[model samples]
Target: MDEIPIFIAILSFIVMCIGEILAYYSISLKYRYEFEAISFGFIFGVATLILIPKSFFEGFEIFVVFGMIVVYLIEKYLAYCPLSRKYCIECDNLEEVIKIKFIYPISFFIHTFIDGLIIAVSYISNIGLPLYFAILLHKLPAGFVLMSPLKGVYKNPLYPGVIVSFGTVLGTVIGLITLKNISPKILLAFSGGIFLGAFLMLVPHIYEHKKEKSFLYLLIGYILVMVITLIQ
Candidate 1:
């Protein structure tokens, strides 16, 4: 029983790795693939809406709301440090994509760290299977999305996958070591808020620079999220 969460965490990491590799190879490097990127945004937005609210209703109201407000503000208004600025330049050219590639690993590292922390906390607390699977499902798409931009910039193809997967592993290690000390519900709620804020911030940016100049990718993202929902 104690080891189950660890096992699942490792499995999710593997899934993420596989997703990244497959995406790196399958996606064309000749063009910027906006669809996969927006799909990632959609998955994150819908999951946040569902999971955070669920945590809120289940009695983590204060934590959930606090998390939501804090993350929303931080992501929306305060996410502009030197590093962030370097990462957020418009992805308009190959040079921009290369800059973004350097930025991608940093953002993905933080994101996956949270993923590992939550996965460890949830399973350690014996949280329900439904939520467990929900978390797992997100990692699958994350790999694809994390690799999308890099596909155009790097020739090795495996570099982005390894970088993002390393983030997951790093997060998992930290979570396994520290998560036992935190209240699972509180931790989960806070993470959910962060996820919501982060993804919410990306939605508009994705639409603004959409390759097709349409919401087709965003719609596809919604459909993908819906499919994950149905799987649940």
Candidate 2:
């Protein structure tokens, strides 16, 4: 319940917002392929290298799988019956619309909330600096990915950033207040599953435009994550 973790959480939220701002400006047709490719790679790396492994080590793999399946099913359902179908009837880009409106927001909220919780816990354990940097390394990309596809969905480009920031803040508050009584493994595993599902969903978009360059960017993104993990 110390104030240090709370302060670190606030800093993390600020870093994430910076990334979101950068992404908002980067959402253009010219860079769509590269953006998505990097996003896919980033998400993939996070799932395989970080989330999934942690879940397995903690013996919470089933929850990871369950989270993935839940995201997958929800995505499938949204494909046909989109949450904003009435408003977007004339829109041809149904997939992006669905993602921006539903999937990404849900996934980002859960994932970032977990990120905040982890930060709080790590700080409370007196091992927060390294973990904070690790989390910081990905926050930019995380924010970028969350904001990249949100152009047409929201009139105000800052909504996604606000949603993610709120989640992080909420998680931090909860972590600070109930650090002793709560077990985050299950939530961690489930969030990992959601990331995995979200990564799968990005596959098609990555290849939709610049096939060759997209693959290259994907590799770069994955390598960036790998490097981050190594440093940690």
Candidate 3:
């Protein structure tokens, strides 16, 4: 495993933790969410247009798209978990809602672990640095997305951040330790597909949640991703 990717992952994890903490404690709730929505669009657009294609040409194949679709469909089930009531219309009672919110963080733990594994596999193949930075930037919006919703449901800033950070660390360890063991073709293709699927899934969801979409933020995200690619 390359030290660069590992270092990047650790840094990304810390960035996310700090962002979550700020979001959890911040009093400007409205401004924060508005910013988050725009950030979401920007990240989604960038990932779809730049990161996904770059990843594919790096070696992920056409068949990997199918694998990604399949995995995404399966993962969608997690969205319906009781915790998802935060996004649902029919949810009632703070007590019941709070009971299930924990489920989201738990699932996030697993998701971040997979993210680490994907990073590990990619870096080992020598396609790691650019993808590593892409993935790292990807987490900033993700951290906001994860904590923003939970702000109302939980009191502690550390709660979600700690769980997410723990998950990231665990995944990084697994990825670093098992770097060479994973098959590059399958891991890269499949993981690449997964990343693409994630981007696709978020686009529609963002539009649905935000009736008035922020094209400016979306464009900024696109430009930022391009700049990151160009600089690298």
For model 3, residues 106-194, the per-residue Cα lDDT tens digits are 65666677777767766776665555655566565556556756766676746766677666666777877876776655666666566
Residue clash pairs of candidate 1:
none
CA lDDT, candidate 2, residue 22: 80
| C-alpha TM-scores of all predictions | 0.63, 0.59, 0.71
Task: State which candidate has the highest TM-score.
Answer: 3
Off by over 4 Å in 2: 1-36, 57-59, 73-165, 175-188
Per-residue lDDT tens digits of candidate 2, residues 55-171? Answer: 555568788889889767755554322432211222355565555577657756866786677666555544445445545655665566566666568878687667766677788
Best by lDDT: 2
Which portions of model 3 miss their true places by more than 4 Å? 27-63, 66-75, 80-95, 151-157, 209-232
From the highest lDDT down, the ranking of the candidates is 2, 1, 3
Alpha carbon lDDT at 108, candidate 2: 65
Please give the distance, in angstroms, between residue 8's alpha carbon in candidate 3 and its true position after superposition: 1.4
Better of 2 and 3 by lDDT: 2
Report, for every candidate in turn, its global Cα lDDT versus the true structure.
Answer: 0.59, 0.64, 0.59
Residue 130's lDDT within candidate 2 is 45
Which residue pairs come into collision in candidate 2? none
